[model samples]
Target: MSGSAQVRAWQPGLDGVVEVLHAYFPSHAYPSHTHDAWTILLVDEGVVRYDLDHREHGLTRAQVSLLPPNVPHDGRSVRPEGFRKRVLYLEPDRLGADLIGAAVDQPELLDPVLRRRIEQLHGVLADGREPLEAESRLTLIEQRLRQHLRRQVVRPAAHRDAGVAGRLREVLDAHLPGGITLDEASKLVHADPAYLVRAFSREYGIPPHRYLTGRRVDLARRQLLAGRPAAEVATLAGFYDQSHLTRHFRRMLGVTPSRFARS
Candidate 1:
């Protein structure tokens, strides 16, 4: 067994955020310590056993865990080939309203959207350049995390809006390229237009029209990367014009579409 281990640290973003990716061989352990920020650990390979809050939990590749600010925890690799994991550290105060009332002490698995968002956040943070992009990426991750935690949970006997929301999202995705009006989206879900507007806003943290526009912009960015001209991509993406697309592209990506595409 190895007598000791070393940790490699990587700082990818301009903000106070930092990523410490660990590779530990058998018998290696993390001594108990605490810090005033959030830590998310995703086990990329092998099994890990850790004691947090005096309770022991076994974690594997498919699982992700959170350590609250100032919580004492210790962990070690249990695999012979050693263990590899990605850890993201974010300041709670910097995160702000993005936490959406989520207590730092609560830990949960990353929902599908959140999983991808967090993954992207890591990718940007891993990049040695583009601290601006990393800051924006981290902000986006916090927003998604908050939305996931705020979603309404239905009881067993309760009527699930799950089916309704799912169906509506399907329709919205189908019409994304062309865009959909608030009334049109409401009709597809068979609910009052006003009620649907509020519900969709609550669920997505954005009105349906804005969400559709954002989706269209996402497509536009891809097209730009594929070598499409800005004007042409703007029209196909359902934007009123190139200037309209430019406004949103800058706001969301921190760069113009043309610049982002090239980068």
Candidate 2:
């Protein structure tokens, strides 16, 4: 329980994730409302009381609440001191259909292992770790959640339009130094945005966004190695600014762009 209350929200730079919220409430309640995305709550301290699917549940620290998309729910502190929590709002398509079904059927999971893994993932994401490393951690977390829920594993059949992935990659490369969005890429390949993301990840082992970011990093590296100014390289590499380029460069390569150039 915290004496004061506060709430902060930010996107995690991942596809299909809406936002994450870190909050501490000493005395607050939420009126019934529905969300278009799934609301996943992780309680860190104290107690949280919420009603879902016409049932009331009191969740304590180390517990998780999985509210499916479009479900009406209300939440508040269960005790006098209130609670601290982290919440993730995810698009329904981000998770497999079967797993989402399992989550809806059993909304609250009381597994310490799952809770700890989720906490770890949050830390890595919040700290701005390497994009590839963060993606790996997130995949592992999803696998563990699926295991805990006892969901069936359904492997995807061979992709019908496997060449579309390659075409999408070509399109991405053609637009570099600028950028192409997921929607734009999907249209070029005549695929749905979600399908394109999954297909690209499966075909190349990285999502489109991460792949595009990596391309930007690769371009930046070359420009830096060629003795170009970091500011010019930022623009040449499709970054918003030098600071933005530096942030991703250091996260991916473990050194600042200038330092890397010096080395």
State every prediction's TM-score relative to the real structure. Answer: 0.47, 0.54
The Cα local distance difference test for each model comes to: 0.62, 0.71
- Expressed as tens digits, the lDDT of each residue in 1-263 for candidate 1 is 34333344444435656433443344456544343456777777688887764557777777666665534456777776556677776664644433422433345564666666667767766665777777777777777655544563522322335455556666777986776776787787888878776665544434566656656765775577567889899998888999999987655534567765554
lDDT of 2 by residue, 71-117 (tens): 45668877888778888777766665566446645678887877777
Q: Can you tell me which runs of candidate 2 are displaced by over 4 Å?
A: 97-101, 150-263
Predicted structure 2: lDDT: 0.71
Worst 10 residues of 2 by lDDT: 152-161
Candidate 1 lDDT at 104 equals 30
Q: Model 2: which residue pairs collide?
A: none
Residue 197: error of model 2 in Å?
A: 36
lDDT of 2 at 25: 69
